[model samples]
Target chain A: MDKVIIAQNLSLAYSKDETIINKANFSIDSGSFVFVTGASGSGKSTLLKSLYGALKPIEGSLVVGGVELCGISSKKLNFLRRHLGIVFQDYKLVKEWTIEKNIMLPLIINGYEKSITQSQVDSLLKHVKLQHQAGKYPLELSGGEQQRVAMARALAHNPILILADEPTGNLDDYSSQLIWNLLEGAHEQLKTTVIVVTHHIPETIKIDYKHYHIEFGDIHEVV
Target chain B: MKSFKNHISLVIALVSILFSLQVFTIVERSIDAYKENLAQNYSLVVVSQKTLQKKELLDKITTLASIEQLSPDNVIKKLNTGISKKNKELLKVTLPKFYKLQLKIYPTPLQLQRLQKELLRYPYIVKVETFSNTHDTTYKLLLLFKNVIFILSLSIVLVTILLIFKELRIWQFKHNERMSIMGLFGAPAWLRSAVLFRLAIVDALIAFGISFVIFSYFSSSAWVSEQFANIGISVIVFDKVYDSLIMLGVSMTVSVLLASFIVLGHKEEV
Candidate 1:
């Protein structure tokens, strides 16, 4: 399988004096589901941010979807991000927009036709079991519903890679299981590579998957 | 509702500024016309011992438009109340010749005084009366009025610009979250700022429409006509198509420019 992401001697930081991820090396294969486990403030989120070009690699090379992100131009970074889907812990839905419109955001940004976007959004709403809440605003939805909406939004454009940061960190057991099932379904059925950062790794996941644990600014693949 | 309120405040500010601009233009034009009328009606009276030719006065004072010889019949009649016919005729022959010297335009106080001195240089000319006191007072009053309007218009322009900028900044803050999310989704700068542009354009159009109605009514009102008549000058308060187009252009340019400023500022911060 082709590698979708490759990082060699990568170091991440917000400023010059404070490094988050130091000398880390990793590669993620296409169509693979991977879990990054770490303690609080162990730079799991920083690693994910680096993958999306939000933070630059401080020391070495990092590439995602055939684009080098170390010193990417804004044009190049935006182009690379077009093929990526990202989900945040807070859901990050636009409060003034309806649930359906929120899900249609990525498709609209990608310049999809209105008819196609509407059909895809309808299908995603059904998949997320929020078809009845399509017209409601994000503020009107519950936490679990909002997260589901965010998931639908992330998958709206059918991106090749999905980066989820603590997607189930604040959800109840039922919502967490639902989000896990959705992520697993996308990886298996759509052949999409997914990288999730979380403190908990459910033991009942029955799939061919990889695990990388971060400890004290170091990342290692766990057998 | 809050958005509507914000838009209304901006529209009101823009309309007041645009209206003040139109009023300034009209008042300036009216003052110019009034001064032209005054210049046409004014003339300097010169008394000479010998009858003077119009060409001679014109040559002496380059500013002179034309000079008319005043008949001595009125002066002789006023003095003939008790005198005999022969004495009245004798008094007319002894009186000096009077000429009215008209000018091309209204003269300043200094120009009037200079003309008086130039006319007095001739050995035949005896006295020159320019009526300088009344003319000088009227000229000063017109200048003071123009300065007051100019300062008022300038103040309105500065205040309106600050108000528009503040309102646009508030709108930017309100939409910042949505715009940032859109930006994270690989949306371009134009796409992220589409909503702000729409808001600015709509509010500008609304202000233009309101101004159009108010000015149209004022332009045709009887009170405005009466005021112009009192001053003996007909002024145009507004032009339907030409003025509207100008106001529309100004309103849109200001709105769009301010909106673009906010968007660029937000982009820089990001």
Candidate 2:
């Protein structure tokens, strides 16, 4: 399988004088559903952020989708992001748009035709069982419902890699299971690479997968 | 392809405000000029040699509070010098110092007409006449300059409105940057900026429309007609549709591009 992400001696930090993830190294395969588990401020989200191109590496090399994040053209980074789907802990859906519009946003940005985008959005909305709530706004929906909509949106463009930051953090057990099931569905069907940052990974091991828990400010694959 | 009339109307309102200011100023200046010219040109001229009759006419004139006393010798010299009136105002003719005997008056054309008839009825007044003549190219030149000043004033007003719009757009740029809030589902910068420029064009058209109406109102007034006589007042309104269209296109293009850049450069919320 092709390497979807690579980090070599990747030191991530907010400032020059400090290093949060000190010279870390990691790689994610194209079809892996990897979970990054750590305590609060253990650099779990920061590591995930570096994999995409939000924060730059302070001292080392990092690459995503063949585009070097440490020193890459902004255009190429945008292109890489087009193939990448990201979900924040907060959902980040525009409150003004309907659930259907929200779901089709990525496809629209990727410049898909309206009819095809609608079909894709329809199937995804039905897959997440949000067909009745398609016309509703983000604030109008419950947290579980909103998360499902977000999941659908992330998968709308059918990206090769999907990153989620504590997706089920604030959800109840039932909602958490539902979100995990949605991810599992996407991963299994598309063979899509999935990287999830979570502190609840130990209890979330419902499926066999590789796990990395933060210790001493670095990712160490649990034995 | 929205007919920018709406935006143009709004711009017209802003421009009209400026033009109205210029109009008020022009009216005041024109009034001042009228007053100044009346004061400079007015006098009790006795065109007859009947000394006693001249005295009686002068006496009758003094009875009216609006009239003043006059000297016989002074009156005779002025009536004789009337033949060389053009050269006298030219300040090059060797006319006697009776030019200093002139008195000032601020009367409406009706009042002046009455005065002309009253003075003409006097036997001492040979042929009562007014020196406010189109043949006096000096006054004509001054009138031309006055009109030019008004045109320049209107032009300044227009430029000021355009400048204000520019300033507002600058503020818009900073606002978008500071907010860093994306418009919505991948809407590009041009669509956002186009909304703003369309508003500006509407404003310009609105201002021009209102100014044209008010200016037309003043132009049609009887008083204004008397002031700006046919062929005497050179009112060449320098407004060609194509010229304005070219300016509008350039400004709209520039504003659209500026808004696009500003929106695109804005910091997106993390």
User: Highest lDDT among the candidates is held by which one?
Assistant: 1
Model 1 residue B164 lDDT score? 77
Docking quality (DockQ) for each candidate: 0.51, 0.12
What does candidate 2's lDDT look like per residue over A91-181, in tens digits?
8776656899878777866789999999999998888888988899898988978888888888888888899999987876776777788
lDDT of 1 at B70: 93
> Scoring only chain A, what TM-score does candidate 1 earn?
0.98
TM-score quality measure for candidate 2 = 0.60
After superposition, candidate 2 runs with Cα above 4 Å error: A172-174, A202-205, B1-261, B268-270
Q: What is the per-residue lDDT of model 2 for residues B65-93, given as tens digits with 9 covering 90 to 100?
A: 33333434544455664556565444423
Which candidate leads in DockQ? 1
* Candidate 2 chain A: worst-modelled 10 consecutive residues by lDDT: A200-209
Best by TM-score: 1
Q: How many backbone clashes are present in model 1?
A: 0
User: What is the per-residue lDDT of model 1 for residues B1-270, given as tens digits with 9 covering 90 to 100?
Assistant: 846786887798889878888888878978887887788889889999988867766886788999888999998877767899888878888999998889987888888888899889989999998988889999899889989998998898889888877887786787787887887788888888898899889989998999899999999999998998898888878989889999999899988887888787784222
Instruction: Tell me which residue pairs clash in candidate 1.
Output: none
Task: Provide the TM-score, chain A, model 2.
Answer: 0.95
- Please write out the lDDT profile of model 1 over residues A1-223, one tens digit for every residue: 8999999999998888988889999999999999999999999988998898888888999999989998899888777778888999988899878999999999999999999999999999998889999999999988989999999999999999999999988888777787888899899999999999999888767778899999988999999
